[model samples]
Target: MRIVEEPFGKGVVVKPIGRLDSTTAPAAEQTIRDALTRSGHRLLLDMAELDYVSSAGLRVVLAAAKQSTAANGRFIVCELRPQVRQVFELSGFTRIITIVDKRADAEL
Candidate 1:
């Protein structure tokens, strides 16, 4: 997986392309943690190009959200592909994480 990060208002928009699985989750987790720290925990995950996610990926996302919440920061995920959305829903992430349909809604 490839992670693209850029400044978005007061936060950062992180786009992850390709599959996020056990093989990729470690790197993704590090990159996301770095972005969160650099952006003061305000993160927006733009999953438009993400095609797949596994249990490892879910752990990464959950960790990020937990960290952001602990720091009193904002973390939002938007533009999920249908398959990816299903995975998140089935994993019970939809209730705990803030997910939006548009990046605009997630903008800081």
Candidate 2:
């Protein structure tokens, strides 16, 4: 999997371009952690190009969200494709995390 990181005035946008399975989740999580440490957790995960996510992937995302909360910053996941959205909804992740239809809708 590939991840692209973009830093903006307010936060960083993490765009995962491939599957987020167990093999890829760890690296993604590490990248996210590094970004958080540097930027204080104002993070936006742009899942527009992500194709898949496993339970391990979800854990990484959850951890990032928790880190953001602990840092008193924002974590917004936006532009989830239908399949990924379904997985999130079925796992009830959508209920616990802040998700939006677009980047503009996210509270960035």
Candidate 3:
């Protein structure tokens, strides 16, 4: 997976492409944590190019969500593909995490 970091309005945005599985979940988690440490909390994950995500990926997402909440920051996922969306919904992550259908929607 490739993680591209972008600066959003008041936070850091992470755009990850390719597959997010056991092999890549740690990298993703670390990337977000590093951003939080360096950039001061708020974060948004743009997942438009992401093709696949495993349970491990979900775990990383959950961890980030919890961290954001604890730190009084926001962590949102945007532009998820259909497959990834299904996984999130089936895993009941949709209820716990903020997910938007479009990047613009998330920006709002």
Candidate 4:
């Protein structure tokens, strides 16, 4: 997977393209972690172009959330596809993580 990062106000929008599986999760995690550090710990995950995610990907997301929380910063995820949303819902991540249907709804 390729991770694209762009500035969004005081935060950064990270878009992980392609599949986020075990083979790609490590790199994705590093990029996201770096983004959190660079963007003052504020991150918005724009998953509009993400094709798929695996258990490893979920772990990365959880780690990012934890990191942001520990820093007392913000972390939001947006634009989840139906299948991806189903995965998150079934995994109980929807309750713990901040998610929005649109990127505009994801506050920095």
Candidate 5:
């Protein structure tokens, strides 16, 4: 997976490309954690290019959300692919994380 970061205000927009499974979750998680540590509050994850996400990927996302809240920041995810969306919905992750159809809607 490749992590691309773009800054917005004092926050950052993180885009992950490729599959985020057991093999890639660690790297992706680390990348996101690093971004969050420096990003301050508004961390928007744009998953437009992510083709697949496994349970490990979900754990990473959950951790990031919890960490953001713990630090009094905002965490948002946008543009989930159909399969990934189904996984999230079935797992009830939608209730815990802020998900929007557009990246612009991911308000800090």
Candidate 6:
């Protein structure tokens, strides 16, 4: 996976493209953690271009969410493709994480 970051106000938006599997999940996780640490918490993950994800990828998302919450910051996932949406649902992550259908909706 390739991670592109954009800054918006107090938050940083991370856009990851390509497959997020075991091999790439660690990089993705580190990228997000670095962004959150550097930007001081608030983050938005734009997953529109992501074509695939594994459980490892999901773990990274979960970790980021937890860390953000613990730090009193917000972490949100937006623009998930249908396939990835199903994975989130199946894993019951849809209930734990804030997921929006559009990037505009993700802006708080």
Which residue pairs show collisions in model 6? none
For every candidate, C-alpha RMSD to the true structure in Å:
0.7, 1.1, 1.2, 0.7, 0.9, 0.9
Clashes per candidate, residues 3 or more apart or on different chains: 0, 0, 0, 0, 0, 0
TM-score of 1: 0.97
Candidate 5 has what TM-score? 0.96
Q: Please tell me which predicted candidate would have the highest lDDT against the true structure.
A: 1
Candidate 3 vs candidate 4, TM-score winner: 4
Tens digit per residue, CA lDDT, model 4, 1-108: 788899986899999999999999999999999999999999999999999988999999999999999999999999998878989999999999999888788778
TM-score of each: 0.97, 0.94, 0.94, 0.97, 0.96, 0.96
Model 3 lowest lDDT segment of ten:
99-108
Residue-wise C-alpha lDDT for candidate 2, range 1-108, written one tens digit per residue: 998998854888889998999899989999999887777789889999999988899999999999999989988899999888998998899998999887777655
lDDT of 1 by residue, 1-108 (tens): 799999997999999999999999999999999999999999999999999999999999999999999999999999989988999999999999999999988755
Per-residue lDDT of candidate 5, residues 65-87 (tens digit): 99999999999999999988998
Tell me model 2's lDDT, rounded to 2 decimals.
Answer: 0.88
- List runs of model 4 lying over 4 Å from the truth: none
Question: Model 2, poorest ten-residue lDDT window?
Answer: 99-108
lDDT of 3 by residue, 23-58 (tens): 999989999889876656788889999999999999
Candidate 3 contains a number of clashing pairs equal to 0
Local distance difference test values of all predictions, in order: 0.94, 0.88, 0.87, 0.93, 0.91, 0.90
- Residue 63, candidate 4: Cα error in Å is 0.3
Which regions in candidate 6 have their CA more than 4 angstroms from the true location? none
What are the clashing pairs of model 1? none
